[model samples]
Target: MRAARPRRRFLGLTATMVSAALSAILAFTVGTAAPAAAATRTVNDIGPVVSSLELNKGYEISRDCGFTGVPQANVIGVLWLFCDTAVSPTGQRVWGTTAGTAQAFTAPSQSLFGDFTDASGNNVVQFIPNPSGFSCGGTLAAWASGIASIPTSSPNPLLIIPYVVMCLNGTNTRPLALRIVDYDYTTNTFSNDSPVGGTGIFTGNPLADNRILGSPVVYNGSLYFYTGLCTSSAFGDCSAGTAQVAKVTLGSTPFAAYNASNQSGGHRWLDPRNYTFSTLAATSGGFTPITPASFDVHRYPAFSGSPFVAIEQDDIGGNITVFSSSSPTGPFTPRFTAAVPCNSTTGDGGLCRAYIGHPESSTSSKLMLSYFQPSDSHGNGHVRTAWIPWS
Candidate 1:
């Protein structure tokens, strides 16, 4: 049976609405200590609580790379933030305006995952690149070793962000790969470390069409990844196709590291064989429309009430909807939908996409939602961070 959830009438994100939302979440919630009773903050810039934890002032350093969850690299008390850059890797020096510029990528380095200090104390970045015209990507072990080779002596090394690779080269063969890149906090330049973690291709046929939908978001301590599988030569084996979810704990030391060290040995994860997928089932026949990719997953602790366990995703119509569930791979119940609070004075109107959440910026009262607004035709836009009540 599904647990009773407290649903809120989310009109818009503001100081006033946030207050009411928190009340609703806590009212029907029963669990650990409730979030703080009060939540009031000044809504600034293009909108309330602009994105990237208020680091960028509506000016995008790189489009769609604004999700800066909990500061990772620390040098002299400075948190070096990590996010993706179309042609290069980007970093932001927290508490200051000293910015790091992006360089070109050999294969146009694509979506990057969260930042973490690695075991060696070096600030390492993990990214999933959409392979373009490029040579054979290197080995997964080499990639892991290269990033691990960075010479730095920090404290905690947090690597990997539950990102699935997609090389998509029908003919080319590369052992399941994910590129591990290193970002120099002091220099701000992104360098391709060693082995390239390329795409994972299962269907040998070109028309097979295997895909991982939406986006990968970390909830609680596990990574919620959804994938769709379809094959042709096998005929009706998977006719209707099967949707499966892979739940990887964040501490798996990134896919590259796991592929390198435990490809055949160590057992750091609970998944059978270090990799067994669970299928997501539908209990009912007809279901409400759902978001393709859940942009943000609030890292609400298990005890922090029921409503707080939510996945925030955006519809194609540009609406940001909230859903609640007991499990990360879930049968989510739609709580409410709200128009993205995006505002702009330049170009066409403002449209927000990529509703990412920053756990470090969240409190008991609110979840920090980061997104890109007023983007160009190519989906390039400045970053905006907003605080939404999620008690």
Candidate 2:
């Protein structure tokens, strides 16, 4: 479940609410260390707390681009931040920003170095034009949702990003489309590549209507992704949401050849012979329910014995749930919950959203997390970083 772009503009909340929210947040320090599996699991607030990144204040960091679960990628040595942006709409409304541009960032330190604009002072990310002049009238704009680096046998690897798009006037976003782009580590420039196949087709499960969320995990030489089914024009309600696993073989181009006329293509780099799709099952053979707004799968590099960990937000972004499994398709055990405290206060205007985790920055002991709160008028929206303790 992604956060909706407000259809109309929202005015900042009152100063009183902001003060109360800050007070509540300061009352709790980062919680105690994570206990063993046998002990009770509880939310802990731990940190060397820093100020929130004010992304909405300047012209470069405008609108919904960095508002949701902004995914990250480490190309060569630099950490690249990808999100969708548009000119903020006029008037009062809730969620529905016109997403037209893709923005990239380079973070020299833990914080970002510059604006989302490029050297030309323009937003580098733009949408693919609609040849047929379909429903929405304008170009189909995409927002970065998942990004992964494919390790080839050669020294240079390929960068893959999966994003969801919306027609200009469309009510909801489409499933997802894959783009194979190039990044220069020395110059810190990104080359916009044409989408691999067509829109809404995933390599392993081409026919399945699934909207991919979170970062794809590469384990045992295979890439694993999590998806939510799309029933209608909008995304699946996922009330009885289940986790589905899609695998892409590493080393080669996993996408099929592009067919412009019919919009049909094969998974060129994916090994069709080895690729498989399966639903995650419980120990009792029933389906496990997990509706994630934005989900991420992380495998500990330092601890060889640790399980593959998964973190996801509930439908409303109110609570973050953690699941652990020996394998991607398995009986995942729900371990704990990190309650989003900002949602409880009136200051946030109940607009807080749980963000995704960056495995590239995580270690065996802690995982980095960021959340968005739109009620904070001081910035475009208040983005706060926190550490989730893992034992």
Q: lDDT score, residue 75, model 1?
A: 38
Give the best candidate by lDDT.
Answer: 2
lDDT of each: 0.31, 0.38
Write down the TM-score of every candidate: 0.46, 0.60
lDDT tens digits, residues 1-391, model 2?
A: 1233433111000000011001000000111223123223343333211212224433323333232112233333423343333222322222222221122221112543333333554333342222222244433544454455655443444454444443433454332233333433334444544334443233221212332333555677666655433122223122444444444444344332211122123221112232212111111121244554455555555434656666655544446667666775545676666665433223322355535554555566665555554543333444444556665
Question: Tens-digit lDDT track for model 1 on 183-203?
Answer: 445444444332332222121
Task: Report the Cα lDDT for candidate 2.
Answer: 0.38
User: Model 2, residue 267: what's the lDDT?
Assistant: 23
Alpha-carbon shift of residue 164 in model 2 (angstroms): 2.2
